[model samples]
Target: MTDSKLKVALVGCGQIADAHLGEIRRILCARAVAVCDQYLDLAKQAAARFGVPGVFTDLGKMLAEVRPDVLHVATPPHTHRPLALQALAAGVHVYVEKPFTVDVTEAEDVLAAAVAAKRLVCVGHDQLYDPAWQECRDLYQRGELGEVVHVDAVLGYDLAGPYGRVTASDPDHWVHRLPGKFFHNTIAHALYKITDFLRDEEPRIFATWFGALPGTDCPTELRVFLQGADVTANLLSSSAIEPSQRVTRVYGTRRVVEVDLDGRLLRQARAPTLRGPLVKLELPWRQKREAARSLRRNLWHFLRSRLHYFTGMHRLFTEFYQAIRTHGEPPIPYAEIRRLMAMMDQIFRSCRANERLSALANEERRLNGQPVPISPLDPPLTTHHSPLTNP
Candidate 1:
């Protein structure tokens, strides 16, 4: 709460730390003052890359010496809780990366610590602040999208992608140790968007998971159905799908809004009023117009250098810093964060239940001298993996 630029420190100099550092530099009200990592060399490397003035190998040393106003916890999911609690206790605001904690219980603890310390905390649900999503939210708020009825959130993964390949090959990765396994690290991206639109306090969740990859226990595919008071939602995360997509489509009583997160595009589809041949002739024309509009908008953004892959992260950082300066509500509410974590807990619980049932069925089949189906929940299939940090 300084009138001058805020001093920022980052812990966990992992892959995601680079993004956080870069975005912090973009915020005029904040600057990266120091960085810390368990490994000294990694800390030095991040400081050198980001031009951060201070570097340390220990969290306590960095906190006491640099005394930053805000701390970014980009560490592994399992480490998030302890690291965040430590920062909050030191009177530092915190911005934790996605999947805030391994589960809801740890998340609650971190929030409680923030309250006790009279500090603010924010989670990295950056996609919700992306341009396309912002537009969708505006439309919904303005009654352009009408009454919300259902939502479909889909995230596609590539098994051979940079981070994916590392987790697939390294059996000892920290992500593998999370309670929800790999899904815990990535599902928050899809769930947060659903929770934004479906406001029911106690939503009912039904989840199914499968290991699409023959040799992996990672459960590469997940499907979840959620029922709110008046809105229903479906979430999907799949590695088998080609042309990897990140999209959320919200269906309302009057129209549908599709947010193409990867492409940074938003589209609206309204109920057709034209009849017979006119309806057929009009829809394609409308689609073509939307396509052309998207092209122009994207081209403009590209020329202006605004179409960045991390635009959402930039916006979230700016808003969080503003909240710190103004003592205003955070960009993403605490209640929403808690609700999303609870939803994730329910999803993973269902996955674990399915595993138990599958095991019992296989055991019964063995007693009957029949061939037992391979269980996707078998050992060595890998569990949790993080897109942010390995440490």
Candidate 2:
């Protein structure tokens, strides 16, 4: 670690910026030097909150004046590409928010810019730092669960009544009008976790589909099938109910592991019994003993898990800092992010078309120089006229 703290510029003062700010405050090797946003007041607010000396409505001005070592882009989906490219071109490292960009083309552009500039670009897939998921990955790697046959992940929430009303009133709010669905918003976390366990093997989207509920603009249920290393996984998301829940279930021949949104893991497998079958069945001694053992195991795992989780968090920020220092690749490579964006495009198309869409199929068509088929049911792209542009 270097003795001098790195100067960092925060672009876009949004909800997510607060999380990054919290982490930056804890990191002794980095300090926020400036804040920027199109909305000058928002930028001022962030700068005041963080005690950053510089605030600007223009990123170029901030870059020129602050000469920050790193630029954290937490803007809306649409602004990510342009802002990140600018930062990279200015020879500054960039850390971007999730859904790297609204489209794969944009992601590729950003990646190409990074490559040309020899800068680092890291996406905020922070869930990878969660300890519970790390423990699950550890177990799988140790072969305690055998080969992962299949993975089922589901994330859902209720956003109809009050939430919908509020969002409707502020449709331009990035969260409300983000280019994609909850799958794109939440699945990245699950995808990152699973990819950590299955490294080097690129996951391909086999199918993507969605369904609707009675009263929601978003899909009621979203499903995606991914294949890798002869293993297939299904990711599902829904917004049809209250008391939101997230779960991941991985099945293997030897045992089944269940993980909740918070990364709690429960493993079930058959073990040798000491007591007679009749006695064990009637008294359930094995069950009792296993439960007690599980409690102790969970506590020990929890402590270790917390440390690992925070360590991963530090690693992520550290990588971002080093990327700024050395102009190298990030922990989560841009190629992976491009793949994610491509998969997300297929997901949105499938949801809109109400049919299974294949990302590989589209890529093949594009590679062959064939025109990709368009779905008639797909939502029309939103159109907006810029006030600064002449009619």
Best by lDDT: 1
Report the lDDT tens digits of candidate 1 across residue range 70-113: 99999889999999998998999999999898888998999899
Show where candidate 1 strays beyond 4 Å: 212-216, 365-391
The prediction achieving the highest TM-score against the true structure is 1
* TM-scores for every candidate against the unseen true structure: 0.92, 0.74
Q: On a 0 to 100 scale, what is the lDDT of residue 147 in model 2?
A: 76
Model 2 TM: 0.74
Q: Give lDDT per model, in order.
A: 0.86, 0.67
Off by over 4 Å in 2: 158-183, 196-217, 263-315, 323-329, 355-391
Local accuracy of candidate 2 as per-residue lDDT tens digits, 1-391: 2557898889988766776776787677898888888998888888788788898999999999999988999886778898999999899888888878888899999999988987788898766655555566777778888877788877665656554444434544455355564455556766665555443334555333344333345444666666677566777666654556667777776667666544344445444445567765744665566456656766786777533334455657876786565645577877778877776675565444433223444556688797765742342222422111111
| Lowest-sum lDDT 10-residue window in model 2 | 382-391
